[model samples]
Target: NGQSTNSNEKKLAFQNIPRLPREVTPFASFTNVIELDQRGPLFQGPGAKRDTGRYKVRPTDDDSMKRAKKFSMEQSVKYVLVRQQQHQQRAQLDLIKKQQALLLMCR
Candidate 1:
């Protein structure tokens, strides 16, 4: 029983021993499989050498004007469609009322 207790204590001590750092281990190779450039344009401070290869073209005045014109055209089209639908509904209601009046007169 005493020998068994000593073996258990030895096992516990073995388990407590710290392993090597992750960088030194075989698993470390998987950690850096895909190295990404984490620094984006936002993180790059002002006056930092910009990557000329990438064009960061912002919306120009012409582009904004075109967008506004397109938005107004779309809004006008939607308004016309809504007005047409309302006109159709009003016409249908008027026809129903005329039919009801004719039925009452006949009765």
Candidate 2:
């Protein structure tokens, strides 16, 4: 009776083994090669038109405008600094001239 029970348990274990579908055999073949006519942009879908011009225009113009504005702001700031330095130098020269005039009168 014990031998019979052991045989039944072995049959149940064999039935529990996993199986793949018969249509997908392990010996099936696959290829990685694509035909030349089928090659196009990877992200684009089948039968979709490519728009090359629209993507090229907007970002370049925006970058140039930003660069121009930055250049103008830098030029204006430099001009203001030069003007301040010139004014300060002129004030110092005027002070020196007034001191010289006072010394001449004292003599």
Candidate 3:
């Protein structure tokens, strides 16, 4: 009787196992994240036959070329402004030092 009851229990357990939900659909793909698309030409080299090289042109290069003369003048103006500021700051500090020395000598 005990052996028969154990067999029935085993059968009951086996029946419960398949009732649980199974994977209806397959897992999502990982190819998109794993394989990123390149931004440039596939192949490029001096010895190679093809000239497909991934070379991204910098925005700064394009900007400089588009406004080469304007940028030069603007850069000159900026340099002069910075130089003037530095000279003014140095002159003020020198003036302050001279005033302090003069006061000390007078005292």
Tens digit of lDDT per residue, candidate 1, span 1-107? 99999999999999999999978987676544677786756566787987779555567966988999999999999999999999999999999999999999999
lDDT of 2 by residue, 1-107 (tens): 99999999999999999987765877657657876775766675777987667555588899998999999999999999999999999999999999999999999
lDDT of 3 at 9: 100
Q: Estimate the TM-score for candidate 3.
A: 0.38
Q: Locate the minimum summed-lDDT window of 10 residues in model 1.
A: 27-36
lDDT of each: 0.90, 0.89, 0.85
Clashing residue pair totals per candidate (backbone < 3 A): 0, 0, 0
Off by over 4 Å in 2: 1-57
Q: Ranking under lDDT, best-scoring first?
A: 1, 2, 3
